[model samples]
Target: MAELPKSVSIREVGPRDGLQNEDPIPTEAKVRLLDALSRTGVRRIEAVSFVHPRAIPQMADADEVWQRAAKVDGVRYSALVPNSKGAQRALAAGFTEIEVVVSASDTHNRRNVNRGTDESLDDIAELIDLLHQAGATAEVIIATSFGCPYEGDVDPARVAAIVDRAVRDGADRVAFGDTTGMGTPRRVRGLITAVRDRDADIPVLLHFHNTRGTALANLLTALELGVTEFDASVGGLGGCPYAPGASGNLATEEAVHMLHDMGIDTDIDLDALIEVAELAEELTGRRLPSGVLRAGPRTRLTASSG
Candidate 1:
């Protein structure tokens, strides 16, 4: 068995990645959700994304939402930017931490940004430089890192090469996204090893989806490999726009519960997180796919009569 990490950092992406696929809710509702999540003791939150209104209509109010959200002290808030234009918008909105995405699969990349994988990488390089020059941090998220719905079983080498290029282009950090939730333990280990071999110093974050019930398992594998950062959603509220019927992200409550029980420190209040998850479900008007939300945490016990 591999040695478990003493603690981990969970970046809550529900406000951005989780809500980007859902129906457009009122701006006030978005602010409410963000405020509720801020009080959950989660140190990092991906607040919003600055994308074209036509591309992701759900996030059309990114500007207003960010401007209205009650900024919390001691909490680091970030947003996603699709290109140079989105990066500029995020910077103008006074965001210092920004994320940009590129897909490992060519087909997925073309479908996501209407550009080939190489072209998207070139764009990412330029975006990273622009963000750095603006005194901002840039994080590159490689979508479809595990497997692509359109193209099954992505090669690990391709993913590592992308990581190499992103680091060379001055990315502050990089995250691997299991976009379609096709990650397994073996694949996760191989991909991490490949990336580590290329640049062990690069900060890595894993984003998993529970589509096939392997998100937690893959997370465990990455944990054993000394990966201490992850991206999860509150109430499991995200899915790929192009992949039909795929599940949302790994639930924050579920991850917190498991980590707490295993003696891993996440510095998150489980009950508070559950409450936020409930609020997310209520706001979306949909039943979220959260195991903890349905079945309470493992620590909950009932007294029995003799």
Candidate 2:
């Protein structure tokens, strides 16, 4: 292993992405979980989503969650918005950072948003313009940047093109999602290099699903590519409904532990992150997919070596 980089940013998405996949947990419980995550030293948190309740019933109470969770100082809280209406509600709720997702795979795009690739791009551009007019930061989440389950193999060229379109639309940043957890280390490295080769100076983030047990390996590939921003769930509690057999998002505790072990300064307190991971499990009444959350980290011991 080499010397690790310091000062990486971990964006906590447990409240929005983590909970949206599960059966409805009360909004109060969601707020409490977000509140707990705020103190764990995460610089940013996706506290809520402003989508229609009909689309995602779990996130129907976005207003209440934002109202309660926004009070935490020193943390930049964001909301996921699907369109102009979603952006409108998010701004009205006093959120400054908003994220909109568009799929790179055409099949997944039509399935998720009922629109073709170009149509969704146009919609996202409009939402970006809306966010800009309202003095908010707009980010693009290019879901299924890896291989899509519905459409077997996703071309790196397609992923690069989607990123280019988003960058042209005035997005502040772009995060590529491994929605199905089907990405390998080679794919991760290749796609990242492809994006950079076409569009340099774009701040890119990685969102991973631990399905097929390759999420951590993909993270390592991104780290080698100098990607410091990542989206993670506290206890690895969210999976893609569109991708069958997909696991939850990469675990926050596992990422923190990996970073700390590599001497990377994530600004996250490991014990505090673990505590929040437990809360996520308790709140959802489901098991988290994080290894560190269960077996614990391999840390330096007080026992003397013989």
Candidate 3:
């Protein structure tokens, strides 16, 4: 087996990507969730998106939530934007790390932002320039990196070309999102290899959904390939609209548990994170699908059984 890194960084995306899919919760509740997550020793958090309210009603109160949430020391926060206007909102609100997303599938891109893939890339170049002028770092997230529900199988070269354009446009970092949880170990290797073939030095992040239960398996593959950064949600909170009744993103507590057992450090307090995951369930009024959250960590289980 290939050696895994001694330490990994998992950016918590529960507050932004997770809640944006559920019925709109009170701004206060969202603030509570963000504040709670901050205390869990999560080093990085994707806190909110600046999209139009009508586009994602659940994120309508993004500004208020960010203003009210506690900014913890040593924790880095980021916001996502869909366009130049949204980028302006994030920058004005004092966010230094901003993420912009465009889908690799043209149909997915059109459905998401009403623009073709290349057109979105063109816009992203300007957005990157806009962000850079403001002294903020721009990271481009390529959704549907593995496969697309609407387009079926997405070619690795197509995803690679998107990465190429984003890199040429001067993106500081890049992430591949398994938008519909369609990624597998094979697809993960293919996509990462394709992207590296284009730019071997660009920073890469992986975002996987647990829709088909391959998120962790895919993570392991990426680890072997030397990809360290990842995006995960607390309690497996977010579900893709395209794949109803399926599992959400990989659970942070579960991922932490597996990583810790492998002697890989995440710098997250697993017990504290699971508590926050439970808090997420309470605020959302629904049970999440995190096995580790429900069953406790391996050491905890072993101790109890003993």
Candidate 4:
């Protein structure tokens, strides 16, 4: 086993990524969900995505959700933006940490954002200037960085090149997304090395979906390389909009479970977070894929009452 880092920072993507793939929930309920997650000690939350309502009806109330979430103390709220208009909405919503997403594969990019990779980069450049001018940082999430369900077997070099372009366009950080759980431990280690080899200044984060049952293992590989930040959704609530049948993001509860078991502290309350996941299941009215939620954490035991 590789020597791992002492702690990892988890950025909750439940409200945005999680809800985006599901049927739209009431705006007030979304706010309540954020409020509950905030109290669970998740320091960074992707509160909302400022996308076109036509594009993602789940986030139609981005304005109201942002307005309500901006009031939380000591928690950093981020909004995912796709273009100049989304950035404007995020800025107006008072999100200090904004994330923009673009797929690494040309096919996925075109299908996802309706633009080629070049056009998406240009939009991100303009959006970064806008975000930075407002004293906020822009984080570019490179979607399908590992592999795409439609495109299949994305090149590591290609993923690195995308991150390089985003950095050149002034992204504060870049997150590699395993949209279809197509990443292996070797791939995880390779890409992390490749990106830092290109530019040591830009920090990297991982957004993983547990589609192929490899998300947890991949995360352990990243931990060995000193990756300290990640993206996970409560109740494992998310899926690739492009990868139609792929599973959702890695469960926040499961991530914390494995991390804590490995003696790496995440400072997250797993029980409390599981409760948050329960609320998510209730809100979405769907059964979640979270293992810890179904089996319960190891710390909890049933008493013998014979």
Indicate whether candidate 2 or candidate 3 has the larger lDDT: 3
Q: How accurate is candidate 4 locally (lDDT)?
A: 0.87
lDDT of 2: 0.87
TM-score of 3: 0.98
lDDT tens digits, residue span 140-214, model 4: 999888888778888888888888888888999999988778888888988888888887789889988888788
Q: Could you give candidate 2's per-residue lDDT for residues 1-306 as a string of tens digits?
A: 534457589999988998998779998898889889999989999988988999899999889877776466789999999888888999999888999998889998999889998899999998999899999999999988988888887999999998889999999999999888878999998899999999998899899888888888888888888888999998887866756445678898898898888778888889988988888889888877789888777873556887
Ranking by TM-score: 3, 1, 4, 2
Ranked candidates, highest lDDT first: 3, 1, 2, 4
* Per-model TM against the reference: 0.97, 0.95, 0.98, 0.96
Residue 265's lDDT within candidate 1 is 93
TM-score quality measure for candidate 2: 0.95
Please, what are the lDDT tens digits per residue for candidate 1 over residues 155-200? 9999999998999999999999999889999999999999999989
Q: Which pairs clash in the backbone of model 3? A: none
Give the Cα lDDT of each candidate. Answer: 0.92, 0.87, 0.93, 0.87
- The collision pairs in model 2 are none
Per-residue error for 50 in candidate 4, Å, reads 0.6
Candidate 1: C-alpha lDDT: 0.92
Candidate 1: which stretches are off by over 4 Å? 240-246, 303-306
Q: What's the distance in Å from true for residue 7, model 2?
A: 2.8
